[model samples]
Target: MTDKPHHPLTIDGEPRAFFGRRSGKRLHKGQERLFQDLLPTIEIAYPETTLEP
Candidate 1:
């Protein structure tokens, strides 16, 4: 049987697993406020040293 195109993941025409869709739809007001509040505390500062292989 053929897999649906809208399916998140499939292997060999069969559903394999569900990795949640990470669509970046615009955040609502509460979400935006929460993001703004929490982002600074959790933010990753860019490399102090260059990335290496």
Candidate 2:
């Protein structure tokens, strides 16, 4: 037998995981809004930091 998850975690898949479909599809109205509205609000500001270790 293979190790498989029992009950699916109904959580939003964040702060722990992000469960999503492997395929891609056109976004619906609500999903579109998430990209147009919510996404812009969380833009990452990059800095001139060096990656030297």
Candidate 3:
């Protein structure tokens, strides 16, 4: 049996880690269409009160 490759659960012993990239790659044609059509309806508006981090 082959051993599985390990991915770290945390970074520098921190509880959470950021796995996503900052500069996003181009989306597929279908994805681009969905983003244009559906994203506006689902996007959140800022509330009057301040939110906690």
lDDT of 1 by residue, 1-53 (tens): 43566755455666667567657699999999988998767966689899888
Judged by lDDT, which candidate is best? 1
Per-residue error at 3 for model 1, in Å? 29
* lDDT-based ranking: 1, 3, 2
Full ranking by TM-score: 3, 2, 1
What's the lDDT of the predicted structure labeled candidate 3? Answer: 0.68
Clashing pairs in 2: 13-17
Model 2 / residue 43 / CA error / Å: 1.7
TM-score of 2: 0.36
Q: Quote each prediction's TM-score.
A: 0.31, 0.36, 0.38
| Tens-place lDDT digits, model 3, residues 1-53 | 21433434454543444468746889999999999999878968898999989
List the lowest-lDDT window of 10 residues for candidate 3. 1-10
What residue pairs clash in candidate 1, if any at all?
Answer: none
Over 1-53, each residue of candidate 2 has an lDDT whose tens digit, in order, gives: 21435434446632333468646989999999999999989967667896566
Q: What's the CA RMSD of model 1 in angstroms?
A: 6.5
Q: Which ten residues in a row are the worst by lDDT in model 2?
A: 1-10
lDDT of each: 0.73, 0.66, 0.68
